[model samples]
Target: MFLSFLYQYRQYLVLGVYVLISVAFMIAKSDRVNVNLKSAAISLISPLQKVVNNVSEASENFWNSIEELKKVKKELVRSREELEKLKGANIEIEELKKENERLKFTLENQKKIEFQTAYAEIIAKDPSNYYSSFIINKGKSQGIKINMPVIAYQGNQKGLVGKIIEVSAGSSKVLPVTGVGSFVGAMMADLRYTGIIKGMGKTSDHVVLEYINKDATINFGDLVVTSGQGGIFPKGIKIGIVLGFQKVKYGLFYKDIKVKPIIDFSQLEDVYVIFKQSEETFYQEGD
Candidate 1:
């Protein structure tokens, strides 16, 4: 019975001894003992504390990277949208500049012309034709009529384009001076010599000036303008410049003068129709 009691009491005896030792150490208050205790606790706990801190820092860094990626993605999308808007704005600005230039050129020519005028845009051309004759976006409703002069602004001067050959309610067909059916009364700019300007048939590259006065002087690079004789075109409209002479019979009163037109039909966009000649107006012609 005594041995059984000793075994049961052995656990109590060991716990009491440990508690008494801890109390003695707390109450001693010796600097050397306190230092030794602190060093022992730190030696055992420091590595465990460092491991916990590393785990916490790694989790924080992972979250921070995810947030930064989100911000960068948002910025990229915004930048792309802004870039598209800027591209569209640039295209619109370019279109406005071209329109402004065209209108300014036409306005300057208007100031120099004396006849009543109406502006018309060239709308279409026959795909089969090569003479650059095309249709204008105006017709009888806009006071356009057959034989009305079509003119365009080129460089600092206005060039003679053609005549209105066919008219509909909304459009008119223009016959360029180079057309085979075209003819105009033209005069030399320097010497006041008169002649008839006519288109060469399909094979010729230049138009011909027929019946120039024999007494009048002709030179290369001479400018020609309308005489306003046939009641068709206004006077002072630019026709073309003399290029060379065509071979003909000697001592004839007229020589075949080749003319180079001033207007560049390849770049043509708009034209002005002279609505009146001298005193006769388009209204009177329509009647």
Candidate 2:
């Protein structure tokens, strides 16, 4: 019985030693297996990581381009708005300048006339085919009457423009110096040679002075003015300058003269109507 019990104890001891050796071997190999698995995972995932980086960079670039485009559009809109504002300002400035010039002309004319003068602004012009005449914004209600002489004021110099032919409640028609049936008794400022200035029925560019004496000594650029002989126009009002003279061999004792008017009818704007202070006295005196 003693021998059997000792043999059994020896068998138990050998079994315990075998189990401990197996556990130690498993612990030692665990570290090497884990290292190999980590290496394989890194190799497989590297390509996918590179692809993700490329996609992220492309997305960032697309957003940057969109931002730049929006900025350009905004700049274009701002520039267009500024240009429109500048154009409006320029138009307003030009209108103001015109108004100022008209006022200055009216004030200077007030000093020259003996009677009360009414200022009229030209509102419309007839078509060129009908000759160069204009309508003014003054009428009988403003003491304007038919046959009233209209003169343009240039600084202190008064230039003869035309006369009112038709009058309305608030407007009048002006027959420019160049219109048909227009005539004025004019004289040379230097020589005092009297002549009848007749319209060419065309433009204020030229007028014809008939019945001028051949020996009047009239030359180019000589100043001509209303002689105030017909009791129609004021004395010393400028008509035009002499352009040329023609001598007809078979004609009577008169020569033909071409004249350029002082006033540019095409540019008529503001004018003053001269109302004679003493109409009866002027006509009766035959001046």
- TM-score leader: 1
Q: Per-residue error at 168 for model 2, in Å?
A: 1.1
TM-score attained by model 2: 0.58
Instruction: Write one digit per residue (lDDT tens) for candidate 2, span 1-287.
Output: 88888787978778888988778667765465543443345334434544554586689778987997899789668756865978647655776999998887766567656656788777666657757677777765677777778898655567899877666556667888788888888988898999888888763469888888877777799999988777777777899899987566776788989988888776667898877744523321100
What candidate 1 gets wrong by more than 4 Å, as runs, is 1-106, 130-132, 201-205, 249-251, 279-287
Global lDDT of model 2: 0.74
Residue pairs clashing in model 2 are: none
Looking at model 1, which ten-residue stretch has the lowest summed lDDT?
A: 278-287
lDDT of 2 at 51: 59
**Residue 12, model 1, lDDT:** 89
- Candidate 1 lDDT over 92-144, as tens digits, reads 58769999998988677778887788898776664454454577777667888
> Distance (Å) between predicted and true CA of 267, model 2?
1.6
Local lDDT at 279 for model 2: 58
